[model samples]
Target: MMGGKGNSVFSLSPNPNHLCISMEDGSQSSEQLVVDDDDDDLPPIDDTPDLDIDLEEEEEEETRRDEKCFMAPPAPGMEFDSYDDAYSFYNSYARALGFAIRVKSSWTKRNSKEKRGAVLCCNCQGFKLLKDASSRRKDTRTGCQAMIRLRLIQFDRWKVDQVYLHHNHSFDPHRAHKKSSSAATKTTLPQPPLHVQVRTIRLYRTLSLHTPPTHPLFQSSRRLELRGGFRALQDFFFQIQLTSPNFLYLMDLADDGCLRNVFWIDARARAAYSHFGDLLLFDTTCLSNAYDLPLVAFVGINHHGDTILLGCGLVADQSFDTYVWLFRAWLTCMLGRPPQTFITQQCKAMRTAVSEVFPRAHHRLSLTHVLHNIFHSVVQLQDSDLFRMALNRVVYGCLKVEEFEIAWEEMIIRFGLTNNETIQHMFQDRELWAPVYLKDTFLAGALTFPLGNVAAPFIFSGYVHENTSLREFLEGYESFLDQKYTREALCDSESLKSIPELKTTHPYESQMAKVFTMQIFRRFQDEVSAMSSCFGVTQVHSNGSASSYVVKEREGEKVRDFEVIYETSAAAQVRCFCVCGGFSFNGYQCRHVLLLLSHNGLQEVPPQYILQRWRKDVKRLYVAEFGSGRVDIMNPDQWYEHLHRRAMQVVEQGMRSKEHCRAAWEAFKECANKVQFVTEKPS
Candidate 1:
């Protein structure tokens, strides 16, 4: 029981459920504290139901705090060694009370550089993107004003200076406040802003794994298309220029400012072409691009019998004018030197362009394309197998002109293809595809590069498909070249190790085994082996100066004849026409010619018979390029000529020994050192 005195004096009993009245003398009575009867300023207790308070829980909490001293946490005004310790203590206290805590403010001493005091506060943070008028301000800021201010009492101990127990906002027990607080404190490094992190994640996740790491993610995520693919091509060409200084890239724009043509050649490709450009396999069949554009690749055979990339082009169309422009661009890039023989698809535009741009070069159609076209045309005919068999024999089996003629005539008559337009056309252009016609040329058996174009029946039979972007396409192309180069290097190393102390039966063969690559050497070895079966039958004179010998290959009762032209002089020149055209097609001497060379007392293979392209050291040949075009004048720049002369002199003087080289190096250093003094003296 409690009693009210005047207006403020009152006392409470020990029972939490009831308020007992008491006098100032501390005596309890069965009476309640009530408002003064005369004071009309106070409302009646029964009328003020909204102002009711829960004092019973507070009294119970205080009683429990006093009873459970060991189990309960330290009471308020507790001391700790550091701010983190104080924060950690309050964090546990706040967790038990069902609320989140946050650092409100902190300060440190200017002189000692020690953290002085920290004010801990309730976490009133909230989200406010919704449109609730009453909840808007509350969502932004709780304004709870409940905090504990801690200060340094002793030098190392911190004491709770002030603790505001009252809060203006209600505690949300269902919210994961502790988890949110821990996540907020986990980051020690500065993280990117929210918007930037969101964008980065979106872009990276949107990109496919097949996309290159260097791809521009921003543009890809935006899903924007380039202006006729010009921007993509420009970026790729610029990157190529940076990575390969010797690379040549040229682009042509149409009247509408769209990319019409593109051509590119790398240093390795140009160097390879400088040696192997004698027989080029020009292929426009394998056009790998998303734009359905014609991407032609110039392929050449290396000594290892592998196709090496010489150059590439993207043309607008397969028209005569477009091909002319492309061919001219390639010619300019290659300094106007065209291949001796051209092998390509049977397209009129390419044929006309080759005749006009490279008139002296022999033009031949790819036998594979011819066979494919023929097969497609005759597949509908009755007894097509017979016709196909005969066609294959005429195209591939016949080794002589007379044999090919007789086989082709029989095939036409037996298949009733004399009236067929495709058969007639093939026969008309037989020389362009027949091996017997081009047998003498050195093609290294490279008829065509089995590449496909997008516009065709999707003949990506080689597993190389079109690319979506210019960079991706170029990357695929470069990777293919890298793989080929590595394979060829490995082959060269293995072949070098496999050679024995004495590699061949004859002196010339032994010398060639050391000079040529394994592939070329093997081809030469076959020719040398065949020489034992070949003999000179008769001799004839051509132009009254060159003597031609009819060499015959005899086996039991059968015999075959070949013409060998021998020019006997201080510099002997030997040539053969065995209908195989092995030397003309492969740059290697045939059996008939080899037999003649042996009979003529030639101790070694003459330098005239050896084309540098087939040699193992072909890549060492120097190929000159003058910007984008050729120059008519030799040593156009006097400074380069002077430098070359000086270099040659130094090289000659230092060729004796390391001592001579060292002396030259020291002299060069002394001369260079005097330049600074000479420049400082002026004029």
Candidate 2:
């Protein structure tokens, strides 16, 4: 056999019976096979001349012929009886080749009689049959055995191995098999673990002069308790610093050198701290030495009567900036929003801090401080009534802006105080103080208490003996006037009086007296009128039944009587009727005659005349039912319950109705089922 161009050729030589192959380039020659096919009786030849002959082709073929050479092949070792045996053989071969190999068993079988099995090779690369059949010599002999029927060819070499099985199947058995005998192999790298980091933060200073009662550091030991006993004091001081720093400072003034007594600070510092601080103090005792306690807290009622707490802390004496900074920090922490109004007794420190921290809040001087200054300015007014009057007008009266200006000018003139620098200084700030007196309502009652107290003693002092308080004087005055008017109406009979109580024995006498008194005056006027006429005789009668008058008129001795019957009972009854028509029309009475009959003790007054105009009875009206049993006019409870029960029944019956519908639907479906679907031919 010869391969195409430039290939080695194999041929049989006649002389030596050797198979020889020549390299296509004629560079080498080798013997491949030696065969002894020559014997004397081998064959008989036909001695006839052939029709065609090619001598040149025969000579060329002889020249190209050469002995074929074959190298020694691999030896056939023991066949693997099972995949495990095949895997062991391949792994050993791979190890020798300096490469690792793994094999997995795919399927297994065993018999009690023979102890034989077959398996599939499942190396990493591809699947292959490891064994057709294999046997164990004895039942006790336990070893995996199989035959390997597949091999891998790679490069110029071939590898034989069992296939690798993953979960019961081969995984790339072909690659594993091909690489089993290879010198080069890939390796896997190891993986690393992940890492994370965290940090902590703190918000405020943790150290304190006083630890809380529940501090974790203080366990059951009394020593810990003693060490942390100052914690409560420190917390109290801190709270004082937060709520009212100035009050805290003022209290500290009395204890000069003591650590708890830092109140006697420098004048400048004290003044700076005092601004708006007076408003924070509920009472003057907060500064007094009477209470020895280091911490004091109380609510200060402002002009509007709102309670504000005075909180103070006693700290060791510190610099002005240190105190101010501490106060600011305390305030910012304690009050989420700044104070709306701040009053002080002219302290510089408070004024400075308030201006900076609470610019929007109203800042004012305490009225007490202002009054003290005012007394000094008006020393001459101690005894003068005119001076007192002027003070009252300017400071306590219902003084308008213009009126106050006039009164202020009069005071300056009357007191001869215009040239006095002190008074001028006071008047210079008149606009601020003037509002305190001019307005009826003030921001703080504390500021206006002196003026209001002075005005109270004089109001409603004359005529009325009642010593009414100024606060309720107006209401009391109006009530007193109402009682006085009621007394005056009782003394004067012409004016209406409250109804007189009636007695069963003479029930109608009082009512009759009222009516008869009115009628007698009317009858006297009619008799005078009759006497003035030429026909003069007239009889006037008032028996409390009704007013009656008869007039006699004569001409030449012929006389006629003219009678007038005024329906008093009808008019009185009409007045008592409750339709209020009489009150609406003439503000008095109507002609319902039942009142007169009742007043005279008549049991059964004629109803026809009493209710004449109102004879027709009003029909009773009712709401009508309009829908089909949906609405009801009577037995509302039964109606609602009936509807509710009917709704539930309808819902319950819906399923049965639906079932009936479903049965009909199924019948329709059966009819539809009977019709067979067919494809029709087109025309």
TM agreement with the true structure for every prediction? 0.54, 0.24
Angstrom error at residue 280, model 1: 2.2
Clashes of each: 18, 55
Q: Identify the runs in model 2 with alpha carbons over 4 angstroms from their true place.
A: 1-299, 302-308, 313-330, 347-350, 380-389, 419-422, 436-444, 449-683
Tens digits of per-residue lDDT for model 1 on 1-683?
A: 00011111111111111011111211112222222211112111111011111223575554343222211122223445455555555554454455566666666654345656676767653333345555533343466666676666555656554556666766543342433444455554343332221110010012234646564321211111232344445456546545553456544433211234556676566656766787787767644223443567777777776677777776656555556656776675576789988887777656767887789888888777778778877888999988788777677667778888998898888877788887778778888988888764556656433334323322222334443444456556656666777887786675565673443477778878778877778777877877778886577656655777888888678787777777755554544455556677567778877777777778788887777666775434223333433322322222332343355456546644699899888877887798657744432
Which residue segments of model 1 deviate by more than 4 Å? Answer: 1-231, 287-293, 381-385, 396-403, 439-463, 466-472, 491-504, 532-559, 570-575, 599-603, 617-624, 627-683
Whole-model lDDT, model 2: 0.31
TM-score of 1: 0.54
lDDT of 2 by residue, 1-683 (tens): 00010001011111110011111211112212222122221111111111121223464342222101111111111122232333333333332222223322222112222112222222222332235125342222122232232221121122222222122322233333344323122222121111100000001112234645465432221110111223333333334333322222221111011112112111112222222232332222212222222222222332112232333333322222223433443342232344444544333444454565557656555454555556656677655556656666576542245666787888878777678776676666564444433232223334533323221111112412233222233235335434543542332233123233333222233433233223222222232233323233233665665554444444356654544333445445411222212212221222222233343355543332222111112111111111234433232323443443343333333433578556656755775676555555673
Q: All candidates' lDDT scores? A: 0.56, 0.31
